[model samples]
Target: MADGASGLGDQARAEAYALPLEDLNPGDPELFRTDTHWPYFERLRAEAPVHWCKESEFGSYWSVTRYNDIMSVDTNHQVFSSGAALGGITIRDARPDLRRPSFIAMDPPKHDVQRKTVSPIVAPANLAVMEPIIRERAGRILDELPVGEVFNWVDRVSIELTTQMLATLFDFPFEERRRLTHWSDVATCLPMPGALCETEDARQAELMECLAVFTDLWNQRVNKPPAGDLVSMMAHSDATRDMTPDEYLGNIILLIVGGNDTTRNSISGGLYALNKFPAEYDKLRANPGLIPNMVPEIIRWQTPLAHMRRTALVDTEIAGQPIAKGDKVVMWYVSGNRDEAVIENPEAFRIDRERPRQHLSFGFGIHRCVGNRLAELQLKIVWEEILKRFRHIEVVAEPKRVRSSFVKGYEELPVVIHA
Candidate 1:
């Protein structure tokens, strides 16, 4: 660990963190609002390390900003419970109490059982079998891009690519795949202003609409014979130990949101990064094998999903700060990845950095992202296809970022592809 203060030792730093959480404000723009996490975490990482702030809307909560502290909380599941907090994993609770719960919000042993149902479907081996399909779809999508013309890359490529892949995974009717996309959009895109309407009634209505579509799919999968795809795998995989229809629906919703949101974000974000740094793009084009290293660097730079919240189950101390029982503590992965204590010159994006893959975008410990390898695979293949097909890709318009803070994704990316 890079010492927070190189001039001092661990003992002095731990002593500073013993200060009260009330001294720091976690509800600031960087911490409270989801628009961006870096500014708030950077300050916390440097200042309080473990601090708390009160929010006008949500209650007061502790913010764990340092890399070591975030990793400590993430790995110590016994001390910090993922399920104890409201709405579970994410800090914001935009969904109505009656709304469905995804696996991200649930803690074991239910989380364990539900994850196992479809875990095999996304396992590395399964993804190896899935590579050709993803690559083929990726090729088809890239081939359709308007050469020598400007188009919105987010819709034309990123979103469509992930959505189509997901449709094939669930065996949904091609045209109807947009329905799955819509459900995921509303479910994860909540909390942002205009995401769900300002009114609770309006938000509930949107959620109900999303739920209706998922319910239809669940029934369809249940009634049909085994098809060897994900839906069938979830339906018949050890029913005695598997999720109930409700639980299955929730977990499926989780998978859709996880798969669509992050993968699409990486696609769009990587393009934006490459466009912003033409030198990096040139470097990548010169040596295509750099795609593997570049993929992790992109994930680290984008940090698609921001901080994940965990509640301290029993009173515990992280990096010497005492966390009370039931206190809401966030593992600010966004800050950790950029921590000066860990990554050297953390802010700059270097494609050929000796250790570009050291960051924690997929997370750490037992709850690390299950589809991590698949995400990386998609990134590498997408870049490979783009490099082969196009001589240059430039961003023609400022990319519109998603309103939600939880998912730092590009909502629209206008690009001109010159083949």
Candidate 2:
């Protein structure tokens, strides 16, 4: 029985390695949903760093798989544009009729101006101010966990903490904070049965409701004195104060997803990964001081946002692959984080790595995540508090992953705490 099982495993591994590059579509939602994307990306990184997919659910797009190649494309925003008008920033081209314009989707002066308007919300000083609140909430959530009983950590811990933080950032109504999670999920999820929304129209309708709710907040903020929250800052800032309704909605979606999904998923992913590598969890337990270092390592391993898509502004060649003007280019940050060339034992999840933050989880250059420092701060505090409270938070089963290529995250993680 053991030999037969070993042979089956060997066959699976061999088939994964033998998957034709032409057949390797890394953007498939099913691959991510089933957590079978690693082998496909590993195969691409090894063989075709800058691979072109002739067809996909999102249509033809070029995949930039290597670490350095992704950096080159990411940093050189001039040649590769992130403009919303040019299909926005996803493998799925923005619908001409349903164009949503946000600053992250803009290039040059506009992107910088609008980004600066909200940057202070996550500025170092502000993060210090927010740290205690985050820690307090994390502690409360951990304290509330049902001892020795199976529970969904994704909902109880990850979503609860991140939703609270998102509410704090927007100064949003605490009771309605789960709305933000719904909106974020709606914005990123594919239109499929059992997903967040089964139709594009349904997704847009929910997002429109999101816009209406935030618009009320925007109005209230604009009429009042400037405050530290993201909505207030945007209302008061010259660059974003006069944004079009669509632009405002787009930015709101960006911030909601940025604030919620990345951190929430990482919180869940970190525990899942540690459980996968128990020795690393033992190392973490042996030295709680490694929490800060381990935070980035977890982010690197989880790669909360799988890929950031850009449009080729001019005909350009990336790693010798010719990319034409107006072509969709996807920088697979997930693959780059695992690229063996840049990271030693890239597949291993080591908390004490020499350079934990060296990976591409938070893309480089001007568009690097503004909330990255804040994200790290929250994760670090959560883990620190977790260590003080529990001996082990055991993952009872494989996590139910979100069925989307963009927002790589968990839908559920069954866990039990052992004190």
Residue-level lDDT of model 2, residues 136-246, one tens digit each, is 999999988899899999999999999999999999999989988889888998887766688999988998999999999999989999998889998999999999999
lDDT of 2 at 319: 91
Each candidate's lDDT (Cα)?
A: 0.72, 0.90
Q: Which candidate is the best by TM-score?
A: 2
RMSD values, in order shown: 6.3, 2.3
Q: Stretches of candidate 2 above 4 Å error? A: 1-15
lDDT string for model 1 (1-419, tens) is: 11122333343335335535455454433232323334555667877788777663446677777777788788877777766235577766444555355566667776676667667767767788889988898999998888888899999998898898888777777888877777677765544455546666665577667656656765677777766566777666663125554455566767787778878889988988887778888898899988888998999888888778887778878888887887888777777888998899887777887898787778787678888887888888999898889878888866666665467777777888776
After TM-score superposition, the amount by which residue 128's alpha carbon in candidate 2 deviates from its true location, in angstroms, is 1.2
Where is the poorest 10-residue window by lDDT in model 2? 1-10
Give the TM-score comparing model 2 with the true structure, all chains together. Answer: 0.96
Candidate 2 local Cα displacement, residue 214, angstroms: 0.6
